[model samples]
Target: EPLPYSAILQPGHTLGMMGGGQLGRMFCHAAQSLGYKVVVLEPTEESPAGRVAEYEVVSAYDDMKGLDTLLSYTQAVTTEFENVPAASLKYLSSQIRISPSAAVVAVVQDRIAEKTFIASQGIPVAPYAEIRTIEDLEKADNTLFPAILKAARLGYDGKGQARVKSVAEAVEAFKSFGEVPCVLEAMLPLKKEVSVVMARGFDGKIALFPIGVNTHINGILSSSVVGVEEIDPTIEKAAQEAAIKIALGLNYFGVMCVEFFILEDNRLVANEIAPRPHNSGHYTMNACLSSQFEQQVRVLAGMPLGSTDLLAPTIMLNILGDSWFAHGGEQAIEPDWASVLALPGVNLHLYGKAEARKGRKMGHINIVNKDPQQLIYYARQVSDILH
Candidate 1:
């Protein structure tokens, strides 16, 4: 598993990215900057990456003609989102090399499967059960009452989860959620949410990014202040070790995100994993020695992984779709645009999207400093403007 410089690709080669959202947009910029060409495989005519990348194929990832075109033009393939269909990845793998493997997609796509695999690996996860039917739900222990129920597939931004007060509430919640199979879990009184973002090189080497302290509004991530607070050295080590284990086990060869819930008791519970660059990691664009997107391109391009150290204490605030709406003719999400621009060490990245719906991530801003209080103050300053 040494660095596969001969077997893997390098800068100046084209990477086919299978998604065209903001993540892909930043990825396109990163790859292009690293001397790698980029081709976006997206169905959206106005995809953000299509606007930024060198070339784009306007077809679904599952389309064979599109896949053929992607493989013919690109040296390797990667994805911006973890939920990209495993079948589509398998098809692409037949024609071109794919990093992170389709099996990683298959596992991370479903909550039940992901938790099961993590638990099997002796990783800590919340007490949970998969419910495919009323009977399955009924089997949930009463001790696990007041649980968080989430759809097994396509759940993001708090879009497909509900909190149930009781077993009776679980039944109604399931019915309201179309009665599909889902994950029901005991709700932990989380002290805070944190995330660890890392990249694994083609040689099976792992690079751990600075941890992010995340804040969510209504179960949807709103802002992330980098680095956790009051963390035991052992807990920090455990989090990194857990990430290395999962990424290596899944044969992942690119950037990945692992979110954790730190309970009041100081135990770290693995909340979920994203086998791609994550929203929380956006702070790295300005604060990390190597941006996650750039590091990802390097990893997939046969280069050694770069440093994961933070350049400064960073504060990142997300501009959700609500920010795009005009309120009294003002951008609702404007994070003190002029004030932020005036502040030193502040950087802005806007995703070129035509339209924004409620709760959709529109863009992000990062502020760097040495003081955590100053970082949080500036973060709140921005969040207040946008929120």
Candidate 2:
């Protein structure tokens, strides 16, 4: 049952966030904008969200003292990343409200469990086989070769994954990962990738944002373009419905994302689920009537969900740490932000990270315009400027 509004919706009340990355930073901004105070629980001394939050609990995720401190301050809590210890969420849920409960996070954090859950929902997922031991790898069917061997846990941003063409290669990769549990997924025909970002309320109401056509470079999302011209109406609706079905299946609350692989035949296969606001949905900050972060805040506070209507054609470009050294230098050099900002319809957002390392997500740019073509053109210009 949902908590009474008086318990959480009161102005100046505190909210809790687990994980202090860019997503939590944005969630803090949204919560504060709605007259709420946010306290972040992250072990890092300096974090993107910690720097902006009203308070910071600098302790490990499972630290009892830390959780108690956070609980003492906030009536509700939400996680910024899926990898946050599910035990920590479960502990908190015994007291305060936690969105996307520990049970939901537990399922999504492991690739094997996540894939099985999606397939069980009657959703189409890529052909995959679970590999927990050398024997399991040997037993894997030859037809599933030319597959990606992914760690079932603690893998993200293209990490903990390897592409193999044979069972021998898969065995070697499995051994390389300390024989940890993994999933071998068959490679599919080439086509496009897309994602749907939606927010589900405690009342079972859901609001979905527009489908984002995503492009990934080296396993990291490079850009996401959302516009009527970017995808067929039928595919968009199908993706949204599948995402909603998954959210319902999980009995989820707060924001979540469902990534889809659109095959060459135009069939949509569920790739994975993100149990929080996703990077692909960053365009919502500038393009939609209500940003995903704001929706997260509303749901946590027991407030009504906000409108997700797209206000304009938008393109989101990820800014990696590589950009800081794009000028061929051992020392990092700042990109020409002045040139990029000079372009009309360009909105820049930089996460408050202290250092820039190759492959690190430092920030993002959202380009919005009424004309879809112009938006893409602006995105290209911004990409050129950043590179």
Candidate 3:
């Protein structure tokens, strides 16, 4: 049996993390500040997380020797992204405790599996069907027209997806993906998109942050605003309850973000689940009593989950790589950070990435003020300058 929560991981113990992206970077900072050592396994040179960690294996996720080395230094392991192979976690779990175990990761790694699992739990999900062979596409219901065909695995940031209005179009899009597994989801008339970020502890207790109202551009999250507009109390309650149910059902032991789509009729349908800390939750880093990253560390360390009260009604803007390129998309030029930072109440966080490519997530900025409208306006002004 795994160790109990009473034996919480001590402050000086080390933690191993898979993936060295911004999520892992933030987790590392949180862990380090709490007096834990972090070891990162990432192939990218000078990865965002690795740069801050005490040790980085700098190898592929499946590197056997590197995995062993990471395990040698840490008491527990966790991942930063769902795309990390489930088998990798499984391999590591044999020797160490890993939160949001490989089994949980496997379920959300594929869109079809994710939706199916959610629906099986009596949770609503956007109507979707699995598509692998062309025959499956041929048999798809005509009602699913104007669907989005997305790769079942490894799709993120609006990549590996295509809009299909007909069976022929879906076939073409599937072929473009080399006939990889895909999911066809009927588009819904969305009233708004929202997400709930929460953490489950080793003892099965749960803590939830407030639901965030989100806006996306080209399927990439652009901004997350909380408390800017009044959400129906019923809808907010349902979203929060459903989020907790999902985490409990998974017996998840770390922070997870569940995205939901609120229809015009005020119904809530789960869109997708990320099995780790998410971009939408970045606002919590500065706006909440305890940030999501801090929650992640606490959970993995078998420590009690912390309070998630919102400290301020806030707006968070994602800084994408497009902001680095000129307005016409001709060449790369850094945005005027001096002017952007000059704006009061702006908290800027730039990932120490060496290069910026179009559509890449570079960093984010959070604006917090007691007045929600003013927060949104200031956030927009700063985003406009950055863009």
Candidate 4:
């Protein structure tokens, strides 16, 4: 049964966050805006979210003192990153509310387990095989050649994955990845990639944002455009329903994302699920009536989910640290933010990190306008400056 409103957190109560990345930073903004206090448990002294939070415990996630301190201040907790140790959530849940519980996070943390859960829900996914040992590789079907071997855990942003065209290549890639447990997924004839970001309330009410068309470069997301043009209406509805079905099956509470691949034949295949606000949904911050971050806060606080209606067409461009360094990586060159911001509809957000390394997420820009064509044109201009 759904938790009742008596569990609904009041405005003045403090909320706890597990990870202190950009997602946590945005969540703090939303919670604070609603007159709630947030305490962040992050070891980093200068984490993006820690910098903005009212109280920050600069201790490791496993530190009992830090966890206790966070619990002392907050009645409810949520995690920004999914890889946070499940044990931490299990320990804290005995005391306070933790939305998208440890069980849900655990299932999504491992690639094989996540895909298995999605498939069990009657959702279609790519053909794949598991590789925990050399014998597992021997048992893999030859037709799955030209597959991508991905680490079962701790993989993100295109890291911890390698493409293999044969069993020999798969063996080498597995060894290169420290012989970790992995999943080898057959590549599909992908025509486009898109994602749906939605919020499931404590009462199981669901609110969905419009489909976001995503473009990635080198396994890292490069851009996302809301209100994708020329998409088949029936396909879009099916994708949205599939995401909702997955959320309902998990009995999830909070903003969640389901990524999909539109095949050459126009079939939509579930790619992966993110149990938190997604990077592709960053456009929601400016384009929607209520941002995904705010939805996260509402769900965790046991409050009603907010409206997800798109206020306007928007395009989001990711700014990576590679843009700060020239092609040779010799000279540091910061993009002309002033020039980019000069665009009428462009909104720039930079995470305050002191050092810039290759492929690191530095910030993002959102371009909002009535005409999708104009947003696309401006997005290209902005991308040129950043890249």
TM-score of each candidate structure, all chains considered together: 0.94, 0.97, 0.97, 0.97
Clashes of 3: 0
Off by over 4 Å in 2: 1-8
The whole-model lDDT of each prediction reads: 0.84, 0.92, 0.89, 0.89
Candidate 2 lDDT, tens digit per residue, 242-320? 8988999999988999999999999989999999999999999999999999999999988888999999999999999
Q: Predictions ranked by lDDT, top down? A: 2, 3, 4, 1
Off by over 4 Å in 3: 1-5
TM-score: which is higher, 1 or 4? 4
Kindly list the per-residue Cα lDDT of model 1 for residues 100-173, writing each as its tens digit: 67988999999999999888778999999899999888888988888989999999988889999898999999
Q: Provide C-alpha RMSD values for all models, in order.
A: 2.4, 1.4, 1.2, 1.7
Q: Could you tell me which residue pairs clash in candidate 2? A: none
| Candidate 1 stretches greater than 4 Å from native | 1-6, 325-336
Q: Name the candidate that leads on lDDT.
A: 2
Q: Write the per-residue lDDT of candidate 3 for residues 91-147, one digit (tens) a residue.
A: 888878898799999999989888888888889998888998999999998898899
- Worst-scoring 10-residue span by lDDT in model 1: 1-10
